[model samples]
Target: MRIYLKGLRIYATIPRIKDANKLAKYYTETNKELGIDVTLDKISAKEFIKTAIVNFNSMKEFHFGIYTKNHKFIGLFSIIQPNYSKRICEIGYWIAKKYREKKYGEDAIKIITDFAFKTLKMKKIFAFVNTNNKASIRLLKSAQFKKTHTSLKSATAFEKTGTHISTYVLHLAIYSDTKV
Candidate 1:
């Protein structure tokens, strides 16, 4: 996957082994700030690099690093195919601590969504955000993702407080081609 979308003060490109060190550093720092346990040990970083390489080399998916024009890493965004025949993919992303509320997330989402619909030829894309993550909800809505359905008791194990999450699904057909 080539670098796409160069404006909006941010650009995104596929992750590489060269990026592993930086990614690991970013993850460790962000996790600490978010009060989440840092799960990517040295072995885990190795495995993550291998998996990311495989996914990119095989054209199986695109995992992008959101970076400034100066090449400073800000966040990550990815589109993943759960199964081959499903013709469906899920979008996931996170911004660096200092980059939040800077519109980088919105820009990255627009770029990735365009890639999903045009380059990947995907029919549907969805995002499952925690119900309590109001920032994410606002971003998704601003990106034109509609509320399709909610899964009660969803994401119980992922949260520290064991909160239920709602799954928000959006069809690309309904989304307008806008800057977001």
Candidate 2:
């Protein structure tokens, strides 16, 4: 699936082995500052592809790559499994090192949120951001996502490192007659 915006294009990552390594490498490299071990050195392209197909076919998660007008790979956007009965989903995204602070995240989020409500028929969209991630907080606000809490649950798996987060929420009704 491809979703176009004024200055960006977001498309689903093909579930092929080649695409998997490319994405995995991009992710690990881009998020290096977070002390994550996700690296090209750790997993072979073959292994990455195997994992990618399994996750891709699970139907519980979705990963989309973001690109420029020229199709330069910049980053990613994702909509994980939703509470289907409630029509609510969690949205997350990131831009490459060079693309930050340029409103790319804002534009991409706006476009995806629009698509989620209009095409996917979602009722609500939620985002979890680290409190220290001021850029993301601002990006979500620009997209009209209301800050629902001052402290959100930790995203890291159960190590319980005191990483405080903030929860943001946006409902479809807010954009009933709007286009981004």
TM-score of every candidate: 0.80, 0.74
How many angstroms is residue 99 displaced in model 1 relative to the true structure, after the best TM-score fit?
1.2
RMSD of candidates 1 onward, in order: 3.4, 3.9
Error at 64, model 1, angstroms: 0.8
Lowest-lDDT window of 10 residues in candidate 1?
150-159
Clashes of 1: 0
Looking at model 1, residue 66 earns an lDDT score of: 88
The C-alpha lDDT values of all candidates are: 0.71, 0.65
Predicted candidate 1 versus true structure: per-residue lDDT over 44-161, tens digit per residue: 6667767876886687766788888888877778877533465567788888777889888888888888877776767677787667778889998988887776332332114546
**Candidate 2: where are CA atoms >4 Å away?**
1-22, 40-59, 149-162, 177-180
Kindly list the per-residue Cα lDDT of model 2 for residues 1-111, writing each as its tens digit. 323444454433423444555566666776675555556643575575465456645646555566666656677777665556788878877787777777677767877
Stretches off by above 4 angstroms in model 1 are 1-7, 16-18, 31-38, 41-43, 82-84, 150-160, 176-180
| Alpha-carbon lDDT of model 2 | 0.65
Candidate 2 to native Cα RMSD, angstroms: 3.9
